[model samples]
Target: MINRHLRVVLAEDSVVLRDGMVELLATRGCEVVATAGTAPALLAAVVEHRPNVAVVDIRMPPTHTDEGIRAAVEIRARTPEVGILVFSQHVETVWASRLLAGGAAGIGYLLKERVARTSEFMDALHRVAGGGTALDPEVVTQLMRGGRRGRVDTLTPREREVLELMAQGHSNRSIAALLVVSERAVEKHVAAVFTKFDLRASDADNRRVKAVLTYLAESGG
Candidate 1:
């Protein structure tokens, strides 16, 4: 179980799924402060309740296209402190790219059918709420396959591999383990990626998150 109590604002158009989520979260020691079936209500709840995280669906009432994503973007802009998790049945890479355009810290995007285990979902929630990334592997795969080429094209094959792992929300140490290389090697590749992507060091922004955003922005379809 999560040690910290996570206050959540759940926004899903389907009542059954929403209730199920509420119960699921309750079972795991999370509190659903407010629930919303529309974008406006979700925004309002986020403002009023100031939840630790907002679990949002990609589609919602009155259009069921991109309402939830737009609201998530607004929430990031207005209150960057509150994490945003996009839980959806569809990939919707275009919308996902838009949501990450601002930043990747405290952001998560997971596909409903792909989340095979309760542990996976809960882990993602915890990661996002704690100002970390938790992107679905499939999301990263789609972005990589169709991602455009520009500055990203300048990266070496190994550097590109490192960036893809980063987009999958893997840390340098994890990437090193997965690649069977030394962590120092992984750090060097990461630094090369940062340099090639033109992500300068900054105290205000997370370079790691910015690098992932650059990868998504360039790869956005």
Candidate 2:
């Protein structure tokens, strides 16, 4: 059994799935504080109830792409105390990485099919709610094969683009030219990327080289 009865807010676009999850959680000794079918509704429900944890589907209404994942990210910013378990039928590595960029504490990313059994799903949920990791084995293996455990995963999309350009031996000015941005703007992104990677050096040029090497290593080259 889990540590205690947890208050949960659930978001799943499919009415059938949402209702089924509500019932399943209730039976597992959880309090289903709120249920939502869309990303906005999920945010609102979370704000109102302040549940201990939220189970959010990666896809949701209107677009059905990554609305749920985006909302979950925002929820984390607003309420870091609320644990998040992001699930999807498909493996979206970028989204998964983004969800875990900050840290894995109180976070989960499990494939929907992996939860075919109620017991396993409940266990994963409880684990996340109590500040433990519950990543899918496939997800872990796939991410690992990229030669990136989580450090590279921590880079934002734009930052990754900038880093890639840097790794190609592009100077700040050259990177700006390639990306069609000002050199000053590129400098900010470069600094942010290096800070995220925690690279240190005696000089700026050396630091950039180290960052580029880290990127190459992460790319498995």
Candidate 3:
């Protein structure tokens, strides 16, 4: 379904990985419109090229810290149509949460190891480009564990399950399918879960999913 010949911008400090990613995307019919070795360069390229998607490293030059993620946020603010996929060597769950604080849609956070799997990497890019979230399973697991413990215990077992699935970037329809419940039932469960977590009125801009993802990422689950 990802037939669009996407124009992509890549931002990675490492030359080897950046080249590899460009080649990979080329082979998959994507156009590598631009590439940058630092956060500032990445932002400049994205702004100039106005690429359809940007594959950014969570850690980029200057500080070798969270520059890439910061650039992604700036991209989201300036160009809403430009999808962002952040790659990281470590979990950096807080960075992920911040990148998705507005909403996971049109955004992705994946561990660097995932790049070795061509199909999976492309799928993540495609999903992001199509306005869907793509979260690494490992990252989700870690976040869910934190939520499992502590005060989040007020959530029922089923609500916990729902929250976990939501953190995994599953849609209400998809969650319903996985839980073997009707969409209406899933909606009720999600509402209850949100209420239990004091997330009422937190659905501004349909950002409840973003709120959940943010909680999980910040919890380091």
What is the lDDT for 221 in model 1?
A: 14
For every model shown, the clashing-pair count is 1, 0, 2
lDDT of each: 0.83, 0.77, 0.76
Task: Count residue pairs with overlapping backbones in model 2.
Answer: 0
Model 3, residue 110: C-alpha shift (Å):
0.9
User: Candidate 2 on 1-221: residue-level lDDT in tens?
Assistant: 54599999999988888898888788878999999999999999999999989998988888988899999989887997899988788766556655655455677778987776877778888888987667776665554344334577788898999887765446789889998999999999988987887755543335564465456456642
What is the full ranking by TM-score, best candidate first?
3, 1, 2
lDDT of 1 by residue, 57-128 (tens): 989989999999989989988998999999998777666766675557688989999999999899989989
**Candidate 3 per-residue C-alpha lDDT over 57-105 given as tens digits, one digit per residue, 9 for 90 to 100:** 8787788878888888889888978999887886765556566555566
The true-versus-predicted C-alpha distance at residue 201 of model 3, in Å, is 11
TM for candidate 2 is 0.66
**lDDT agreement of model 1 with the native:** 0.83
Model 3 has how many clashing residue pairs?
2
Candidate 1 residues lying further than 4 Å off, grouped into runs, are 147-221
Locate the minimum summed-lDDT window of 10 residues in model 1: 140-149
lDDT of 1 at 40: 99
RMSD of each: 8.4, 11.2, 7.0
Q: Estimate each model's TM-score.
A: 0.70, 0.66, 0.70
